[model samples]
Target: MNAREEILRRLGETPAEPAAYAAIPRPYLRRHHEGDAVELFAERAADYRAEVRRIPGADLPAVLGALRGHYVVPDGLPADWTAGADVVRDDPPVSIAALDALDGVITGCAVAIAETGTVVLDHGPGQGRRALTLVPDHHVVVVESARIAADVPEALERLSPDRPLTFISGPSATSDIELSRVEGVHGPRRLTIVITD
Candidate 1:
């Protein structure tokens, strides 16, 4: 080895022990308001211009029937949820062109936050890949009442940190300088949330 390389190698070989990280104090509140997570979530979701519908588990078939166009769903979705509707299952992951041509997409969320009206998907069972939801013009999200949380922290606690998470508050929209609202800019133009008990 050269003299300079040997000297550099010797200098780099320090026997320093790793230090333990200090625990940071958590002073923030977990939840601010506490009434009904379902109610709060519905209210906030509506405020974001998303159509929120409440239905019983048994009525899913009827509600889905009213939705128009060619429907697509994740492979992990329950068979009974689709009922008699002709649905294209995304088992092999559809292309962007295919998803765009579809009328709408149906997905089940990992968790719903009442405080922020946010629905989170972790690409888990029933919730398809990110592109499946993004490319479609209409998105139908089914959220069980039992999976609702009061705040972000509660929702985060229930989700796995390593999973790919998608948090959606409302339909994709943007406004021009004169405040002319435009919908379906980068994501779905319409978001329909069905809350089930």
Candidate 2:
């Protein structure tokens, strides 16, 4: 019999034993100390070669100015948050392409998973479209401790299935046959996450 038919035949002969499926061991859960989210995020980002920064809400303007590039696409970010930067509107048909041509992308995150050091984006207002972050060479994500979760499951619980979500662990990279790592293979070469209190 073919592989598919053989599998079906085996299934037909098997009894529905609940304990048979329960042989797998439960996953070990890690416990994080309180007040360690920010530190854990920084540590994980650094491990992945992403630059991490901490800034006050008011100093956001200054941080944007420091990043190189004449064009800046602020994803669904607030007007005041991008007042000084050159803003790209979403009305134009080529807006997505235009954003891809920009120097970098900046946006707010829906959640930050401390255990994985991952940032989750839901494309919410001031967060902009997913393409804005995907095509850029650099991505600067703003995360707040209030929205940081201790683990992936906790972060997933906060997200809805209806939204288009993007989870970023670090800068985009892939290894070649020679075992050399190449950055910016499919996404941004540089990733910077700024955590605010």
Inter-residue clash pairs, candidate 2? 75-128, 76-126, 76-127, 76-128, 77-126
Tens digit of lDDT per residue, candidate 2, span 25-47? 65766445466777887788778
Model 1 lDDT per residue over 151-184, tens place: 9888987998789999999999999999999999
TM-score of model 2 (CA atoms): 0.77
Candidate 2 contains a number of clashing pairs equal to 5
| Maximum-TM-score candidate | 1
RMSD of each: 6.3, 5.6
Off by over 4 Å in 1: 1-25
Model 1's TM-score against the true structure: 0.86
TM-score per candidate, chains pooled: 0.86, 0.77
Clashes of 1: 0
User: What lDDT does model 1 reach?
Assistant: 0.91
Report, for every candidate in turn, its global Cα lDDT versus the true structure. 0.91, 0.77
Which residue pairs clash in candidate 1?
none
